[model samples]
Target: MTAATSISPIPVAPVGLTARARRFVEVDSVRVPRRGLGQHRRKWIEHGAPAVEIDRAAVFQDRWGGLALPPAPFYEGGPRILGAGCPEGSTDEGWSFRAGSCRVSMAYGFRIGSDGAFGIDAYRWTPLHASTDGWVESLALAAHAGRWAKTVTRIKGKAVESLDLVGFEPVPEVQGVTDTWWRGKDSLIALYRGEAVGLDAPRCLEAHVYGGLDEWGLHGG
Candidate 1:
């Protein structure tokens, strides 16, 4: 098994996303407490993430394997999930290896293909993005956009399909299939389709609209 799921296509962030992707995506930052165990530091460095992302004294490999909830859409996200995708063995698929357990199910994570991008680890080597930074950027956007939006309208079950995304532009930072984000003039629409697709439960489909936002809330630090 690798990071690709047979149900979905290979998630590619693509070279041309929205204008927001032109510059660095700003997300809500948080403090992560890492126990410095430098055992897997070398792999992290080799993975091509920024040196500042993980410390030399921090434990790199996941001593504790992440628990994947079969197939579900309720993947609670945070920077911690990245920690779950710890380094794993290597493969012939572009030297793909386990990077970290995403903590959002999909069997946690596997830094698939040559890009070393994080995603489900299975027969398919689909990646969440072209690089690790893209994942972080997408996660940050999800965390911050909801908080800033004054109104968060939720849609679930059959209602989720009714959401019209006519004017919204796809947010490519996440490069998600079941989970996706869209940007509108004054709002952000997020959809959680993991459960609906993974479990084959149409009612599990859910969506949210984050409306009423200013520049600061959307992208400002």
Candidate 2:
């Protein structure tokens, strides 16, 4: 899923889901109207956002704007992805703008330095992925694994440290730096170390195991 950052053409991104999004959470994909972006851009300019940067942001919104991803364990405790329908001004962008937020209004946007990597606030940048597709890929992975795993377990704080992961391999598609997904023979473990680091609370460490996955479920059919 290569996201193009251009304004002349209406940026189009694949809806990123098939017929199965309803399995784990009922996901609604809404198309953001291009006409509304003029006002969104005007708002960004008043906030002193750079034009090229704003255009890139606007282009991203034009493409992947309206799909709100359901929250997983480590996500912001609500829908992690924003379905805001338009870009909103934020001091967090430095020169760009913001679009997504969770329960605490913790903002998420594409990073300019990383050429549009999606992440949380400006300070932490991306605790998520190297690109927008990586974010979508993570959601897809979570949905697929969560649906098939017959037994689910959640652990937090110091208990996360005791997990034995000798045979578990990191799921590379997430492109995770701090948080990661580990796939074992029959279990997929989502380890969220970034949460504790971001909030300055060690007890925020979390890990969820999707156990009882068969080969089909583990790798997807």
Candidate 3:
């Protein structure tokens, strides 16, 4: 009798059983609207005649942009990145100013055209950078403010002793967490993780406690 050979196939699992978890800490993308400086600046002026500045060397606007001012960080000696935060989302320019101590994560999407605008998003951990020191919580909030995450734009003081509060905002949709050092201007400005929905809302946003930043080895400074 001839020897018989046998072959076995590998087992397969069902697709539904192996689907990804849809509700376990989802990070939505940030949004950037098409509005320009002339449109959004009005809000800042209404709040207070917040100073605005536009960079000439930036890629987005040659000389036609304004600051997306928020509030100043409670502490001094913050971290700042040049050419970030612009009004019209573009691949050209952006600016960010972060003082105090904070940890921030940012994400943005883009599209190109004559009248095109992109989406921008950011997430922050209050007292994010503990080693940075001073108002570590507040600093993290300041750094991740909507004003800083949208576009690469910059603002500077005309004089040496002026207080400049650079700001950023999310595009009305994405959401996450936000804690309260306080809320809005005149508030303590703590990290508030949450989501953005419709230019003035936080749809599915949430926040965790802000404490023991030192345990993360980020608050010793």
Candidate 3: residue 109 lDDT (0-100): 20
Clashes found in each candidate (C-alpha, N, C closer than 3 A): 18, 0, 57
Q: What are the lDDT scores of the predictions, listed in order?
A: 0.51, 0.60, 0.25
Local accuracy of candidate 3 as per-residue lDDT tens digits, 1-221? 22222211221211221111111101111112212345445654465433433221133332111211122342112212112233332243332222112224323221111222222233421222211111222333434442233322221223211322244232111111222332222211233322232122443232222222232222211
Regarding TM-score, does 1 or 2 come out ahead?
2
> TM-score per candidate, in order?
0.52, 0.71, 0.20
- Which scores better on lDDT, 1 or 2? 2
Q: Per-residue lDDT for 1-221 in model 2, tens only?
A: 22333222222335553333323223323332333366667776776656676677667666555545555545555344443333334455444345454555553433323245555553355445665555666676777887799988999999999999999998877766667789999999988776576556679788889999999777772
Cα RMSDs, all models: 11.6, 7.0, 21.4
What's the ranking of the predictions by lDDT, best on top?
Answer: 2, 1, 3
Candidate 1 residue-wise lDDT, 21-125, digit = tens: 323221222222323336556777787643444431132233212211122223444223234333333545534444444544453344544444544444444
Stretches > 4 Å off in candidate 2? 1-35, 77-96, 103-114, 122-126
Mark the regions of model 3 whose C-alpha exceeds 4 Å error after superposition: 1-194, 197-203, 212-221
Point out the higher-scoring one by lDDT: 2 or 3: 2
Q: List the residue pairs that clash in candidate 2.
A: none
lDDT of 3 at 159: 26
